[model samples]
Target: MAKAFASQGDLAEKKVSFTEVGRDLWAFTAEGDPNTGVIIGDDSVMVVDAQATPRLAGKVIENIRTVTDKPIKHVVLSHYHAVRVLGASAYGASEIVMSEKARSMVAERGQEDWDSEFGRFPRLFQGHESIPGLTWPTLTFNDRLTLYLGKRRVDLMFLGRAHTAGDIVAHVPDENVMFTGDIVEYHSACYCGDGHFTDWPATLEAIRCFDLAAIAPGRGDALVGEKLVNEALDNTADFVRSTYRPVARVAQGGGSLKEAWDACRTVCDPKFSNYAIYEHCLPFNVARAYDESLGIDTPRIWTAERDLQMWEALQG
Candidate 1:
């Protein structure tokens, strides 16, 4: 059976919907589940982010088959997250692309993240044993890489650090569309556990510079119009601010992590009550916010033990 989760208890289960945003641009979204964007070029194809596992991504590839028969040439990792990049090998893409910073993050904490995420979201990692190992990018760049899928131009650029140091957005100029992987999510909880909260808003602003008519966000539904795209970015920016402010204030006041978490809950839970993953993201979000508020530059690795300890601290 296909498992599902409810968002707002109004949007139907398995919130997966595909909207053709432009010529050969399709957004595969599942009710605020991690979205996979597809760009079909004349000669080949490029997938924005692989799903959580080969089984999950194979389903996406099956969808691509419905659109075109050309081989999938590239699978891009927007950042090093188990849910995003683990299914990369399934695409059989000759070139798996990522930012150099993201590659480093994979080298440093990918394994831990894999374990951590598997624990947090067992449903996403349904076929866990099938994951060969940490998915490594064959091609990495500092800022950007442009590919010509026949005559179509797909520019992958690392505008700034947001979700992770190596976050990148895939821009399709002719389509006036951008695939923002977790950099911007509409009506969903922003996972700041491994994020750069201070840099996230600026990154969102940088994304606004593009005259994009549509966007395929990492989660939530595909933003099909300029109005919806702006709303996604603005809502994401507001969520980031709401996440950081209360935690920072409490931390700066010399309050305990628990106190900071309480302050954050009081503010966020009320407004973002309907967002997906609110319960799952809050503890990690507050922990990262507290760390940033205390001048911690890089996010700490989250092991199973650390996750439990943090949960207990917050629950108590």
Candidate 2:
């Protein structure tokens, strides 16, 4: 019998966590699921990443209301993934900020990604109907954009291309807190389907240059203290290297895609097998690594059909 396509079978509800990472920074994590960063300023709040759907985001809003009645002033995206940005409408923030490149990716393949991801992971879309449509950024920045939440200053920096062409990190200078969307995952697998392998390490280096007291990653528990924070960054860097290096080597040798996939798994699985989404992401990650190793810089659209085709071809 054929295997189920991608993450279709991963419908179990994950345990959610809301923990304080900084003075007023909160991380909403779901057992290695996609996380939401909460930054409370003097007068208002800033949400780092929107959840999957409006109903999902409502839960985050409920938590935000617990501490502060202050309105959420801005919603910032770390990258252009549908699971991260589609629930943006629920925030009602004055500005939805994203990197200019992310906005372009959304325009090019947002609808297709929505369709593809909703099918792959149903738990994140419990209230899929509540999503208004594709989320568009009302404000976009080329390299960096700075915003002040009263006294606190938030710097959104595009630390080169890693997870996507438009990956940005939100750095809170005073508190030494950085919300690195998908660019840095703790124990969770780095979802590299839309990633830039060769550029990821350089981006990670740029992130390391910051003196981070705490890090709220896209998934996994909030990393606090210098030791754990360094571990998370190192782990993320290791994951990207483990997959891309083996796959790139295979691709460079003119090996088949299946060979690239197997070679990558051989190198990565021993260490990352237990990470969240490891199995679901292997095919797409390997596919991207193979193409990028061959010089395909711009990512190809991943439709539901292509997702299943690649999954079957690699894992069947």
Candidate 3:
């Protein structure tokens, strides 16, 4: 059975609006769904985080057509996830960019992650057949890279690991706006299956340091102004704390995965139960917490088979 939070009723995917944050920076966001951002320059355009597949990305491109006609010269992958990067080929982007760490992750466990995520959420991958293959970045940097879009400055920074080891954020310095892939989510579950729990809090702090006039979060509506920005950061922080602490506590007591899952339901369900994908994320979150509680620093790779095993082990 497809697992979903009690709070998330029948959520059907739909078209989103393209909100302009700055002169040429805009964000396309669906209702509590993964977002795709566009950065238009004097000469070319850059796409941030492609949707699940080429068919789904066509919707994003259609939205882009309403804005500018510039060819998409660059496609930036925030991390190596099938949902985030698999649709790059659809854009016909001349250059695909990523952090070196992200590329390494693609080589290590990219296929496994693709299977796991596809198995978990089929709705996100609307046009499943449109997936060309795994997306590989043509250009990669270590920590940071500054790309000059004509006169516009778009900085891609790998501040720290939260969502994944290769997670990076797109910061348009001129606009004081940052597109946080999954590092910061507004009213959405923090999918921490590949996350760095110990380092995630610190990563949020780094994101907070930016002079953010507006923020395009991984899911939900975009946040504008400092007040909303602060709210996003706070909510994200609270969700992470609520997810990790209780599971860690339960695991430390020699609790089984089911015990930890139940504990999470009691604590996190009340607080973040309304967030997007909460039900789908809880079991994986608890499993990671259990591992972390035992002094495991890195999260275990989530294969599709492992996902089912964990779900069966905890759900029953």
List, residue by residue over 226-260, the lDDT tens digit for candidate 1. Answer: 89999999999989999899999999999999889
Residue pairs clashing in model 3 are none
lDDT of 3 by residue, 103-169 (tens): 9999999899888878766777667887878889899999999997899899999999898888999
Worst 10 residues of 2 by lDDT: 1-10
Candidate 2's C-alpha runs over 4 A off are none
Give the Cα RMSD of candidate 1: 3.6
Model 1: which residue pairs collide? Answer: 15-30, 15-31, 16-30
Q: Which stretches of candidate 3 lie above 4 Å from their native place? A: 1-11
User: Where's the lowest-lDDT run of ten residues in candidate 3?
Assistant: 2-11
lDDT of 2: 0.91
lDDT of 1: 0.88
Best by lDDT: 2
Candidate 1 versus the native: TM-score?
A: 0.95
lDDT of each: 0.88, 0.91, 0.85
Ranking by lDDT: 2, 1, 3
lDDT of 2 at 222: 92
